[model samples]
Target: MTSGAITFGVKLPNLSPLASRDSILTTGTVAERLGFTAVWASDHVVFTPTTEHDHPDRRFPVGFDTPAVDPLVALAAVAGATERVELGTSVLVLANRNPVVVAKAWASLDLLAPGRVLAGIGTGWQENEFHALGAGDRFRRRGSATVEFIDILRTCWSDPSDGFTGEFCSFGPIHFAPRPAAGIPILLAGRSDRGLRRVASHGDGFHGTNLNPAAAGEAIARIEKYAAACGRATASRRYTTLCELDLRDRPVGPDEDHGGIHLVGTPEQVAERIRAFDAAGISHLALRVRALSGSTRKEISNRLSVRAGVEQLERFEAEVTPLIA
Candidate 1:
């Protein structure tokens, strides 16, 4: 990653070859053309039953009725459409899928995208989705399982001499072909204090705290403390955290507020806050352009339309990218 400007990426809502697919691809490509650093997709095996207001903390802006696209597939399509932009999952829940399968898919993506793949992974939150996929048992100890799963992936990618033996994932002497030409950057996401500790100990980096910047700063400190303790000072360079941005409606101002959760306001305010995060030690900020998890008023909803999505990309490029550059 370049050292000067911390990277900015947007999450594209791609559920299928739906009516919105072409628009998202075109809009995402436009974002690349306008100078956004990367594009990301969310992961969900299946939508769990819930009302928009059911889980008060849930943030899918369009609500449960909207389609949930496979992040890998959506990213692959986005990769085809754009050039010079990194692609990633805001987070792919590893508990629901075989880690080996994910390893292969992400590795292959790296092959095609070359140096432009970021592996953002999480343990998962929806137990019913796992049950629907016959992977419910994997959730019993997801925290532990996620660690082992990532270890297995590393083993498969790294030299076979670097082996692994864990309770959930164990393997020996398997040749996985076409190792990613450039190693994929793996980012781990979780909110627990223990989860932060785990990231410090075993992960390549840390991920988002949803909308909590204070907690993210604290988590960064925790990671640094543990990194220093474990003789992993070199690994400290890999820390990345996500920043939630809600730009639905507001004038640009440094004093702009997001209810203390996200960077709300115009592009400059968002970028300035992002710079603050960079100063605090965040390497990446995953931008969610649409309200993928909440409700919006009619006009704000209109701004989230495909056309306005392109405008936001342009605004960020013009107002935000230069500050970091």
Candidate 2:
């Protein structure tokens, strides 16, 4: 729980259909070599064609056609190739899968990686996907279900004799073995009131997305206030956010603005933005390297090969990490 210099991580190249397993593996190894503290993967079981709700960011389409690898499995692959970087799930949808199953999967992963797992979890936004996963009944009560999931995970990890009987998830006394070397840190994602409350009440940290420095500061203040109300200590909890980085060398656009959601422009400008977030109490930053301009997602993915990704990582390490570190 001790604070130190800010740490950085990057998302694995598993978001597009063109991203091969080899590229994903290479991305993790390169990130470790470049002195990244962690390498993160995202989750998506299925994408429905239509949704009543819009995407939280409204920048991307809400189609499940994109080829996103399973976060835990992808992280397991990364763990095998890298020795130092932490394996993280940027935001895994918890309510879609059974809590017991998730606990076992993550516990096994922790055993394989041995103290290099960060579970960034969320209730998820796609209700249609929940229905497809046969957890539609639990969708309406996702917040409660997520709380129960955390309880179940902790119980399963804490001791063999422990069990949980929650309103949504209940299990008899069971012996779960190969416990994690240390308890896996759970970071809650999303910016809703319920999300922040869950972070304060049950999570060890917060994993935010699309939030600027000012907004992130406000969110941290609110999280602290909620934590204090819940009698939970907040001084040691981690605050991490995800940002898209435009590493292509180019002049700043007069009209192009990211609304502070991304680290765009020159490396120096991106470094300055990182400093601002660090000053706002953010402890970790997970960056997604932008793909080159292309006609389609597949084309863009093709352009962002492992070689390109490694080059970008090298540049960031040389130009930005030194400035921030």
TM-score leader? 2
Task: Let me know the TM-score candidate 1 reaches against the reference structure.
Answer: 0.85
Q: Mind giving the per-residue lDDT tens digits that candidate 1 earns over 36-126? A: 6788777776766654444556554454556777788878888887779988787889867787788899988887788888888888877
At residue 161, give the lDDT of candidate 1. 58
Per-residue accuracy of model 2 over 23-131 as CA lDDT, tens digit each: 7888788888878899888888887767524454434412347777888998999998878889889889998789988999999999889989999998887888899
Q: Residue 232's C-alpha lDDT in candidate 2?
A: 94
**Global local distance difference test of model 2:** 0.79
Overall lDDT per candidate, in order of appearance:
0.69, 0.79
Count backbone clashes in candidate 2. 1
Cα RMSD for candidates in order: 3.6, 3.3
Candidate 2, after superposition: displacement of residue 99 in Å? 0.4
